[model samples]
Target: MDEHQGTAMKKKSSHASAITMNKDLEHWVSSEEQADISKVIQERLKDKKPKGKCDICRVHPAKSICIKCGNSVCSSCYFTMVGLCQNCLSKDTIEKWKNKKTDWKKILEVDWVD
Candidate 1:
């Protein structure tokens, strides 16, 4: 019986008691408890909302999202390839232009673009 032994014994007893308590309370959890848990989770998630416009068009109010680019482009800004918005332009196409730089062009297919 040294200090280390005493500490280890105490820790073992504490763990055993914790296990006993958990077993005793295992049945205490019910559907209502799960609902309360979900409610709390929902409240936490409700607080997280994106606060910005589409990174592409920068015109229409951003309502859609693009996880690939980590942007909240507006629905009109989310365009497709060959019809992609200027912001959505892929790096490969950008490099293809070589030294000849151009202004951001809205993908022609987007509704907002002319």
Candidate 2:
């Protein structure tokens, strides 16, 4: 076969294998079971929110997580602009990060990916 035909054959086989994998997955997990599992995952995620007082203040409920240290902090203790808790925000830290914009959600949620 020519190179183009070989590529086409590869794609067709890959597509067929993907369909077979999907069929196997369907046999292993019914739609109802998937829904039930989704509900359980949601429940687990709901409970994953920072559940106690601030790591810094020990008073207010944590409203944010530190990007550098992963400490749960209250709004008062966390600087939204810097995306850091009070403990992590020194003069040196401010100087180092002065001109940067911090993506708090992206930085903090990276820990959850593992």
Cα lDDT of model 1 by residue, 19-48, tens digit: 999898887678998799768655654544
TM-score of decoy 1: 0.27
TM-score of each: 0.27, 0.37
The residue pairs that clash in candidate 2, if any, are none
Q: For model 1, name the residue pairs that clash.
A: 54-73, 84-107, 85-107
lDDT of each: 0.62, 0.78
Best by lDDT: 2
**Per-residue lDDT for 10-109 in model 2, tens only?**
9999999999998887876789997997686556455455558999889999987776677788988888986678788786876666667877668887
Per-candidate clash tally = 3, 0
Evaluated at residue 104, the lDDT of candidate 2 is 65
Residue 66 of model 1, lDDT score? 45
Q: lDDT of candidate 1 vs native?
A: 0.62
